[model samples]
Target: MDRIKFGTDGWRAVIAKDYTIDAVAKVAYATALWLTRKFKNPAAVIGYDCRFGGEMFMEAVAKILASKGIRVYIPEQFVTTPMVSLAVKKLKANCGIMISACNGPVNFNGYKLKGDHGGPMFEKDVKDIENLISEENEIDLELLNWNYMLEQGLIQYINLETIYMKEVRDNLSPEKFKASGLRIAFDAMFGSGQNLIKKLFPDEVSMHCVVNPSFHGVPPDPVRKNLNELSEWITHTRDIALGIALDGDADCVTLFDEKGNLIDANMILLLLIHYLAGYRQEEGKVVAGFSSTGKVRKICDHYAVPLIQSKIGFKEISRIMTEETVLVAGEESGGIALGDHLPERDGFWAGLMVALAIVDTGKSLKQLLKEVYSITGPFAFERVDLELNRIIRTRVIENCRNEVYQNFGSFKVIRTESLDGCKFYFSENQWLLIRPSGTEPLIRLYAEAETSDITLAIIEAARKTLVGEA
Candidate 1:
């Protein structure tokens, strides 16, 4: 009877409260029904991260699927999101499910659904599942069985880690990487990326990989604030050419240069665009979310590639990717969907691509970034999350809908975009976006400028406006 609503990625809630066994059962039942109706006795590949109780949740869902005469393939051990995706594609399963909160706090957990193509389901597919949830019959608790399902061959255990490692080996060019002799350090942050560096590189790279479920009490977001140890280690070691950080589910990535500087997602986006457009000489369009930096536009313009800007979610980018030959589709957040791969965001793939780019160019990651800056000029970006009561948050955003900004210090609003939220574009390629966070009771302000000071000032002014102080 609990209200189970899916958010930006999937349905995530505090484990015992909203994500109770009953609620998870309901989701599993709904998914089974949806899959049965859509495919011929559909089978699913289920995976889980190293989060607490992840395996239990996976087993619970698998039992639910098996009870409904649906085949279920559960991983033998903890696996990353990309592994589930790969299994979905390799086994030709009807759907893929991963049990993880995906960079959220330790107290939370979630479920993600991947389509047949091994990518996040399209928005309409999620909507269809939601619709089915309302009409489906509640699952019978008496039908769930741990041993009977295994005996009946309804639930099969698979080796997703081996499958994923083989895929990485086939796709990644180790010879090119060894040519550079670049020593890379990876901080898995106690998420699913723990074994990836060792599996992919073997003895070729150095790494600091740990699978601590606590993640030192901080949410497993790969941002500068949470990656202090990685930064300090990279700085002091000096042998690491790059430090890669992956979130809890290993579906998003952030990088640190050899100098221990956290390279923002915008910089990564630009780097991918430059490599794909210039080096690979791939002629295709680029898609990015509105909160992304304008440096993407500069790179696209320089390469004469078409660029499409969409709303804040990677799902929107994924939608565009299906219709066009998108070279790269990414958001301001760490989610990246590369060309020819599944349209879903995979941090493991992103990290591998970063390594490949460095190898192909025969340059250090920092040197490659320097080249990108020379082409697009320098850009600084930042975002601030302002927590508020839900009612107050809604009212503040509604009130700002038609509000006009005459001036903010020396800046003037030149244009406004209300596609996802209220984005006020100012002169000099600087802008501020005010949008309500879908996953939390907060308003997020994203701003970018040519200098850090200007970016911070814009964020401050936007905060004042949100609080009615300006």
Candidate 2:
């Protein structure tokens, strides 16, 4: 049997190799066992995205859970991660599972486990699940069948769209948004968020919804490079005050300003933090990932809100959120989990909150961003993905552990943090971070500075250091 390892979120492997039906069945059986042992009335909500063979994999999972006598609620069709989370919260299920990777390439599929509160499983919970997988017992999957499970009333089909729509309606005030006359463009990137915005706004907002499994041969990431068409549409129409793009499973978001310019996640984090703390008057702790910009700290300090930094991953944020009344938890990768909601990141909810911010303030996204920058100062951020051999990547990280940097260009090293990776903080609000990619065999270098030139220089210096060129 192949060793199944779960990453920051969950276990993900290329289909037909590690992600075969047998492997999926084993994981599903183990998850069912774990849930049965934990919850008094074990019930699970299962969902999948529009990935290839998603439905097939979801069916396999459903069969395994049903065979164990655990009630399973499988969505009737492909849906986003948020939909499954909403169902789990509403149905009061013990856990939820999503069978699609978020923003990965076409060939990759994954499984994400959610807690009963509709948040990603805590780190310790994930570790427990991994331990369960490690001590797995052989189980027969051939006897599992959908018909038998349905006849036994062990499996039920649910309309995730209906449940999700009701939640959106209950949370969002369309009348308020319409009164603001804010035109927004939603690009689902051919992922599970395809019809979600349209369903929520209908006649109020204009959207470009598509459900192409190929994702036009590009990964379903909401980065600027993958969203060229969205930029073009926004540029030509000039109708949308903001353009929003959601990842494959609709768990993360990327925004484009009215001028068709990509807004980096750092700015988005700062904007949301400012709005939630200053405008909403919410007083609580704020948590952010290590790779996030220092602008967040500045804003939080100005408001006297406690700021806690975690390693890169929403799971870490989720863990902290459970312990404190976290006002907002976010990562630099466009995943924002707001307070008063499920700890899991939801692009749909984040985008809607941005809309609400605009409506309530009577300003465009650009205007709101300008105000944020005025208070936080200018910050430019960029990342470089360097593909390397696995051994070389390991060596590079080990080398960075002891490596010290006195200065880079004209910036001086202020402090250093080795949280999840090596992050070098420099004077003049400049910093660089280097970490190995969990999902791929690559080293990612992230940097933020006062100017674009300085950011690029910092990234280049870090790349050279990793490659032994510096």
Q: Write the per-residue lDDT of candidate 2 for residues 209-316, one digit (tens) a residue.
A: 666777778888988788888889899988788888899999999988888888766777777888888898887898999888878889899889999999998888
| Residue runs of model 1 more than 4 Å from their true location after superposition | 134-137, 203-208, 404-410
Candidate 1: lDDT over CA atoms?
0.82
What is candidate 1's CA lDDT for residue 369? Answer: 94
Q: Against the true structure, candidate 2 has what lDDT?
A: 0.83
Model 2 off-target regions past 4 Å?
Answer: 134-137, 204-208, 404-414
Return the TM-score for candidate 1, rounded to 2 decimals: 0.95
Q: Total clashes, candidate 2?
A: 0
Return the clash pairs for model 2, or none. none
lDDT of each: 0.82, 0.83
Per-residue CA lDDT of model 1 for 1-470, tens digit only, reads 44667767888888888776777778888888888888998899999987778998898899888888888999888899988988898999989999999988888889888888777777788777766664334876666778889999999998988887777767776566766778777888888878887776666344336667776788888888998888988999888877788999888999988799998678888999989899999988888998899889889999999999988877677778778888888888899878777677888787778889988887888899999999989878999999877776877777668665555656678888887887788965798888887665578989989999999999888777666732
